[model samples]
Target: MPLFEYRCMKCNHDFEELVAATGRTKVVCPNCGATSVEKLHSVFAARADASPIPVPAGGGCGRCGDPAGPCGM
Candidate 1:
């Protein structure tokens, strides 16, 4: 099962749902009972055992000599 986020256009309510593969396309908003619910992409948190990742900023760090922060140049 996967969790998906949905926002209702009619009532402007946001909610999440745990659904199977077949139920992903046919979800309805529970708050407003409207079929105009828009499904949103779900974001998952990184696991504890995951590798240390580099930050994705454009500039480099001036204080630490690292690419973690923005370089003023």
Candidate 2:
């Protein structure tokens, strides 16, 4: 299954739904119960680097509670 983003053209409502990849699925707006919808481009995350982003001294590394961050124990 894949998640899809849709906007209701009739009601202007935004919502997400999980659908089967094999066939066409009917999408309906939860807000107004309308079948008129437009699929929106989905955005995804990709790591540019393996290392965690660095935080300056005294700025806590949110993950490990370190004041200076390189994310290493």
Candidate 3:
């Protein structure tokens, strides 16, 4: 359970929080509760001109899960 992206430096208010582990965790700024929170460097991006989810070459496709088949890279 790790999802934490917070930026509310007293009211800049951007949020996402579901963290169960990370040292000294006391992040609080649900729009102006303001523990002066700032931890924002989250990244997940995929669309460098992307189109490939055709995904059926057998073997369940949980990222190269090869049960003796279809794990051809």
lDDT of 3 by residue, 1-73 (tens): 6676779987798897776665766879877787888778442222322544334556454446655654435
TM-scores, in order shown?
0.54, 0.55, 0.25
How high is the lDDT of residue 12 in model 2? 92
What C-alpha lDDT, on a 0 to 100 scale, does residue 43 get in candidate 1? 34
Which residue segments of model 1 deviate by more than 4 Å?
Answer: 23-25, 45-52, 55-73
Model 2 alpha-carbon miss at residue 6, Å:
0.4
Residue-level lDDT for 63 in candidate 3: 49
In order, candidate lDDTs are 0.67, 0.74, 0.65
Task: Report the C-alpha lDDT of model 2 over 1-73, residue by residue, as the tens digit.
Answer: 6677889999799998887878988989999999999988452222324455766667767667776555653
What TM-score does model 1 achieve against the real structure? 0.54
Q: Please provide, for model 1 over 1-73, each residue's C-alpha lDDT reduced to its tens digit, 9 standing for 90 to 100.
A: 7777889989989988777876436677888789888777663422322533334456565545576564433
Which structure among the candidates has the greatest lDDT?
A: 2
